[model samples]
Target: MRTVLHGRPLAARPRRQLRDHGDVHQDRLAATFADRCEPYRGYGAGAFTILRKIRQGTPWKEAAGSAFNGQGSCGNGAAMRIAPLGAYFADDPKTVTTQAIRASEVTHQHPEGVMGGLAVAHAAAVAAKARLTGTPPPDLLGSVLDHLEDSFVRKGIEKARRIQTAEEAAYVLGNGSRVTAQDTVPFTLWVAARHLGDYRAAITTCVQAGGDVDTTAAIVGGIIATPPREWRDEREPLPDWVRR
Candidate 1:
């Protein structure tokens, strides 16, 4: 239980500076985290910078949009640290998507960003539900996809359903190379689906697929690891680093 929640921040921190700080007033949250945690020390660049702008009194919509000179960010940041929220609301797919949107809008104001978070949350909710019901692992990806409204995300998940291996998933659905929500979430859900019954395999799959490993692993790991310990006995024990 504790181990599961702990995994989310550990997996998320190494890839990016932010820890999905929720919807805090950017500067206050930034200062608090930056001062308290060693990991938040020097890593803020993309989303963090935008967050800073918001803290300095810029509106969230404008601050986020100005990140790439008004292009806004579609980064996987929202998706990377959102699994816990999904698990927390495991019984409600509608609430998962709705809340995911609110969560992402705090920093990730782009449609793609919000979509990515929603997709991951919806998947986690489905995964959590499956765990609760003892459902088998077939069509898990389809279940996750059913809750999404984004066309590109839907198409990507559709592609993921046909893919058999993580390597193939990475190649076709993307492995987070672009860092956009579209480039990250699809493949993560695929990996999560393929390795839902085994936590270690899910993490390994993300590492092997290779782009933005930490974030992908965080998203996949968080969702796949949500099942109770009894349901996941086949999963390898936590790695040394994770346990420590």
Candidate 2:
């Protein structure tokens, strides 16, 4: 398990950075993530920046996701920043994937990065809806793969072929601390896949296998918070402080 590290670049983005120059349409929701999110389980730093821009009235396209620095999909910022999308669409995966990609585009411009967020958020949304509906979707992993539009995230999953445990997958897939969707998304997917239904266990396990705490937590939280069975659970709320 990757233990937590202090002063690591995997730091959560501050809410204060929600600049007025960012986006304009969904700026409110994004800003709420900035204001209320915990960086990890909440909106991440990069994510906060994009959200604030959105709230301050930036279009989702220009806030950050647009061909950033002309590199396109350069950072794990996309995956790191996309948790709330899953929560909002907790009842609908198709909606969750659609919105998450839209949200991820605020900064994570690369198709791979966008795909990473899409896969994770969609998985979480499906998990939540399944538990609520008692239908429990088909193979959790296959479902995620089916929805992802990026080929890179899919390639990373292929890289995970030899990985046995989440830890090994981390060694091969990375935890997104590197800020590249390629580096971070695959590992989160592996961990989430391993613990498809057990949300609590999933979060703790990922925390222990730490790399990017906030991003990993957010990814796993999206999954656990919305699983396929409505198991009895009681813990910290996601805080309605968001979307203010």
Candidate 3:
């Protein structure tokens, strides 16, 4: 969120609670990937199905949405579920962020939404780098305002910093009830930054913010799960397989 909007460091970096590292985050991501499919509303669920099949080593192309013509586009959905990729890679954020967009193209074709994915992925990737490097996270709003393209999502991200609390950001910007990047991504980024060091807190705060609970939580979880410094070493390990 900050990377796209502000492009600087976080204001008051949140305290991190190291726990459930390793495979837990990745497995949860796979589950979220599947959960988003249950409703399967036209375009919402198609990307994951394609993603799973593709990851299985299939050279697949074509998605289930209409945003970037036939090329597909950006959507908050891509931004939301990409944390596991960031964590899995842990060091190479660009690769993970790229993968996040690829995940988005399977469904969203909208440029704004695609940009949302990129922003979220970049945050996650950066978070991973911070976790490994022991560097404190930057001011999130500044980061987003600086990196992300000027769009509805970008505007909303700027608003997030002013809103003080996470609840306020979600209320004013959006909690993703509409599912567009404009409606959801900014708030998700806010939540991620607000809880940068604490994975569980970040996710719970998303739930408190309401609207698109899982999606918002997932986005926040992805960002906070990996924060600046080697916090993971202090946390509990995640399960190899998620109940999802």
Candidate 4:
């Protein structure tokens, strides 16, 4: 919401949003994410560091590049929030890919982390196009994989293609247990692919898989589902800034 309202380039919006509102925990839902949980009160560790630097007026590239002893972070943090960006560029796959990388670079400079965001963004873009056509993507994961370069994240997604069940996917591909993009994006994409038309089912599968449930559910939900009204009613209203 801040991104759209700021009227800035997509690549520039995340840094400003983080600087101004990164630590606000507005969700009223019952979740155990540390950032959203009491006492922690901010983004995950990787994002927190980047946000701190951004708040200090550090450039996005420098802030991101400085993390984890200069290797940057490969955490799923970048991927978790990128589905909307993919949908925004739904008609342009190339832009979706490029912008996703730029967006991730604000807080995740590691190639795996950037690739995770790329994959999820592309998945959301494909799903958005599918929604417009009123036909589900015949090979959603494959479509996302086509846009990705070689990486463990890509390999994990390939492994996702061979899995038949969510439980099996969570077991083999991991259920965001490691909090890395390599561990999380593949399984979330698998769920999104299998339950693209069923928002409730997609979220249920994420919760049942259990590890990093909030992030996994957020990624899948951003791709293929909007929460039902009943579910929405249980959560806090969107902030005024988001509404604007």
Candidate 5:
């Protein structure tokens, strides 16, 4: 949500929000994550390490790239938080892709990790556009796959396109079981594509799939639906600093 609020304005006023070379400034994003992400709670090990590096005053790029002994992280962390950025730039596919890459690189530098963010962002962008147009997309996953290059994530999505049930998708696509982008994004996208108009059903399906349920539900929820008022009231409120 913060990324969307911060980044949406950048579309109209790039000079104000972006650096001279047109890249997103990572300082604010890093600070946001540092303040909100607890070390050992629900965050993955890669995310914990990257956030620790940022808090230690390491440069954002260096901090992200240093994870996993320089191999960088290929975890689903980036994809999980990127849907809002996608929705914010829903009308601009190019910006969606570019900005999603920039945002993911702040915490996930591995190509697969970055691609995971790109895929989810692109899916959200498409979903938002469909909502605005009041027309359901005929091929949501197809559009997302079109924007991606060959990767395990892409392959999983390709398989998702063929699968018919959430159970099958979780089985064939790995259901966030490995907690990698390859294991998570495809299954979430599959759920979102199936229940684009039914938020409750979408979330229920995610939970039933059973691996990394929270992350999968978060990703799917971010793309397809907003929580009901009662649902929102049941959870801890957003930080005051978070813009609605």
Candidate 6:
């Protein structure tokens, strides 16, 4: 949320400015952002690996390139962190998708990684727009799918639409157990679409799915939380460090 708010000043050329903001925001988040708060102990391999490289003086490009045997990481890390940017450009899916690419390229260089970022950003944009227009949940996933170009991600989303429940979505669309974008974004979108108006339910689905729970939950929470909706207090708040 702070990222989007920080972006408000750069609204004049958000497409270009926000892209740089993403890189700066990431460094800040991994550095000072964590230090100012109480120590956080939960582990996420993608985050730990990136932070380790950054601490060792590796450039973002080199650090990212070193992942997955130089093919670069195809993890959902890009998608997991991109939703707020999407909401910032909620009025334009094209802009959302384009800017998402810029953000993803900083750390996620692979096609699947970029695609996952685009899918989440596009979905978040659509969801934000839906909140403004009172668009229903049923239309959300389909609307996002229309703007996506990757066949593998598209196929997963297409299958997501056929799924009748969150459990089914995890089963058929995957739950990020593979740690790849292809296995994560589609199911996150499915839960976001299914529970667009119910933030609690969306997070619940992620938690219940049982694999890479944090990333899946983060992706779902980011997209589903974008649009104005009733946020039940019953849902546990994210750690102060996360919000900070």
The numbered model that scores best in TM-score is 5
lDDT of 1: 0.68
Error of 2 at 73 (Å): 5.2
Error of 5 at 84 (Å): 0.6
**Per-candidate local distance difference test:** 0.68, 0.60, 0.58, 0.75, 0.79, 0.70
Q: Which regions of candidate 1 deviate over 4 angstroms?
A: 1-44, 226-244
lDDT of 3 by residue, 32-128 (tens): 4433333323334445555454455443333334334554545565676555555555565555555555555444567787778667767776677
Output the worst ten-in-a-row residue range by lDDT, candidate 3.
Answer: 7-16
Residue 209 CA error for candidate 3 (Å)? 1.3
- Candidate 2, residue 111: the lDDT equals 77
RMSD of each: 6.5, 7.0, 9.8, 7.6, 5.0, 6.0
Candidate 5, lDDT over the whole model: 0.79
Better model by lDDT: candidate 1 vs candidate 5: 5
lDDT of 4 by residue, 1-244 (tens): 1112111122223323434543212121001121222223335677666666665666666777898899999987668777767877788898787767866766688999999999999999999999999988999999999999999999999999999998899999999879899999999999999999888899899999999887788788878846777776666554343444
**Candidate 1's residue-wise lDDT over 13-120, tens digit each?**
322222243322444433332232332423337666765666566766677667766666778767876776777677777767766676666557677887888888
Candidate 5 ranges with C-alpha deviation above 4 Å: 1-23
Which should have the higher TM-score, number 3 or number 6? 6
C-alpha root-mean-square deviation, candidate 3 = 9.8
Better of 4 and 5 by TM-score: 5
In model 3, what is the error at residue 196, expressed in angstroms? 0.9
Per residue, candidate 5 scores C-alpha lDDT tens digits across 154-188 of 99999999999888998999888787998999999
- Residue 89 error for model 1, in Å? 1.4
Tell me how candidate 2 scores on lDDT: 0.60
Please list the residue runs of candidate 6 whose C-alpha ends up more than 4 Å from where it truly belongs after superposition: 1-43, 226-244
Candidates 3 and 4 compared: the better one by TM-score is 4
Query: Number of clashes in every candidate structure?
Result: 0, 25, 41, 0, 0, 0
Evaluate residue 111 in candidate 6 and report its C-alpha lDDT on the 0 to 100 scale.
82
